[model samples]
Target: MKPSLQLKLSQHLALTPQLQQSIRLLQLSTLELEQELEKYLQENPLLERMEEEYAPPLPGTNDTDSDTAEASVNETDTATSSADDESWLGDEEDSNYQSASSSGSFDDDDGDYQDVQVATTSLREHLTAQLGLMSIPDRDRTLVQCLIEALDDDGYLTQSLEDLAETLPAELEIEPEELQIALNHLQCFEPTGVGARNVAECLALQLETQPADDTQALALNIVRNNLDLLANRDFVKLKKLIECDDEQLRLAQSLIRSLNPRPGSKYAALDARYITPDVVVRKLRGQWTVNVNSDAFPRLRINSLYAQILSKQRGSGLAGQLQEARWLIKNVQQRFDTILRVAQSIVDRQRQFFDHGEVAMRPLVLREIADLLGLHESTISRVTTQKYMATPRGIFELKYFFGSHVATETGGACSATAIRALLKQLIGSEEQKRPLSDS
Candidate 1:
């Protein structure tokens, strides 16, 4: 093709390195953000955490000023005062401070070691411990371990015997029948249903371990054949199919319900995460108000002494570092500012939820908040993803307030959250003798 000269005008977006970092930090959870901050502290010499004593006091206050200002503000603005009481970048001196601290020597030459205890165990480890006590041949033990590895987190053996057999080492020359025997032995292990192929089989394994009785027999039969009817709560059909009366059916169901569907879960280690809410909501003078949680954002600042020293030395590469440090501090402040704004908007729209509970939650969308705040929908999503708000009702994720709209009878729309609340209420008040049917 011949060279052609043409001018085209178009607009597109570009994300700079700092902008990309800010966006990534905005979307991170509280734990992840803390980790990111630690990484920055290690890499950037100019960045340092602001200690409580070293932090600057609030505006219009002096070191010699009595508690008069604080007392007066508390008295006049009881509702809004507490919400806006603390500085976002100030170290917490109050008893309600939730941050943890450690006091210990970092010297490795002291020859002191602390033994930390694990609070949870995994399913595989638990099963393997039990396997160690079994009096089986090494070959059989190896086969059982193979089967144990195949069990899912829920303790269900999702793969078939034929499929599992293919996974064995070629030298083992194990058949499907041998694998089935190994699985049978594994199913007999503790937790009751570690090797069951399906929900029915899992329940059956538990029932087999129980003492033989009428209820046990009936439960086994129901689990084996009429599990669908039982699951549907079709007491009438279940009675006909299992040849049992209402009382007997209820007893059988009680037995079945007592069985653990997910036996492996109890042994699974919990990956628990503690959240510090980004904002706090409280009723201030009969009006809901939002306050940014001081603990959620770390107290960060550019070391003034270091900056001054670096400024004295020209062409030392420290100027650029100083600028970067300032940019980071500013970006961190802006991140929380955006979070606070988004949280405030959510609190304003979800006031009813604060007043009455989740049942009063209205329909909301990211677009609505984005439009109101003059931000992009993706930015709103990032702000709301890992952010949380603590209210009088309870702590909830910001995204919890946004739901798909459902049409109401009056041609308006109801939030799926509100509909779920209504459904839960209906189900809770449903009659025991006659459960409500889906209409």
Candidate 2:
């Protein structure tokens, strides 16, 4: 074979750091973004909360004026920290402070934060607390600890009994039934569905607590035997299998629908983490307005103290430090600019969806917005990934706007969001006693 060289022009996606950050921020839920910001603040030298002005505003203006005057006072005044001139760029002088700062946002004064009410104990905590109330011996308690560790966030025991048994201490041989008993006990906890084996079992656990009726039984049966039918909207076969008329079938469907498929998920178990919406939407005078949720986003500014220190590098031949400082400034600006641009793009494209609701959501894709904003598709994807926008419909991730296209029966293109809305509406209006079943 003769060696040949050919050149062709083709584009392939390459993952750049900035694009990665954009995608990461896009899909991040509110909590994830907070953690990310905390991570960046720990690692970077040039980022900090803007220092408060030393002097009060003009004498005549009351604190109420202070509220309206500062459009950017993100949170309630009570949560604001007193002015700190020193920036948090890991102080090299004190190793302990440096170690503490670099690990994450750890402030000695946690008093500045608002008290966010967390509903339930974490899965491990819930199990451990229950374990304490049990009459098990110390050795068995140790075994129970191992068992609890094997359980996943959804409260289902992800690890097999065999795996857990193997992990147990060789001196104390625990039977599988003993492990089963511990699991059964965990299932009886306040959250109800914590120790389910699967979604079917989870729903069954919840339904068992409800009133004993045909609707409940039929729902249980449908979930156990005809999960496929429920997912596919195959109401005819479901009705035939369950031996119910249209109205009864509808009731059964409604009953089943009301049951949380992932029972342990509500708060006790691990559910999908949702991003905080950056912008809030409200309607006034029949017009929609997008207001940035300034509270969720902390006021980020270039750390002047750090900048001053870097400025002092003029006489010293520390070229690397100067270059690093410049990179930090540029990256910070790019991060904010990208976020703002993506936010604006979302507001522009999803305005109708906000005004009219999900049914009116136009078919959108990452490529469409990427082309509009002169960014790569992946960049748009990342930018929208975990980021949220609070609209009149409630909080939604930015990526919610970029729905897959679904063709309607009337030959028009619709978004998956639109279809979901249609599905919800169909289910909502169907005769509750006899719902439209899959036929």
lDDT of 1 by residue, 305-401 (tens): 8788877887777787777777788777788888888988988998898898878989999999999999999999999997887776777889999
How close is every model to the real structure, measured as TM-score? 0.69, 0.52
Q: Which candidate wins on TM-score? A: 1
Model 2 Cα lDDT, one tens digit per residue, 1-439 = 9999999999999987655555555555556666777876776656665544533232122333122111222221121111111121123223321212244333533422311212335667766887888886676677667766776555666666777777777777877777776666666765666667666666678778889988888877977788668667888887888888998878876666665443333334224433455555555477554544545544556667766876877665544544544454455445545666776777677778877888889988788788888988877776666566655466666777887887878998888888889899999999989999876
RMSD of each: 12.5, 14.9
State the C-alpha lDDT per candidate.
0.76, 0.61
Worst 10 residues of 2 by lDDT: 80-89
Candidate 1 global TM-score: 0.69
Report the number of clashing residue pairs per model. 0, 23
In angstroms, how far off is 200's CA in candidate 2? Answer: 7.0
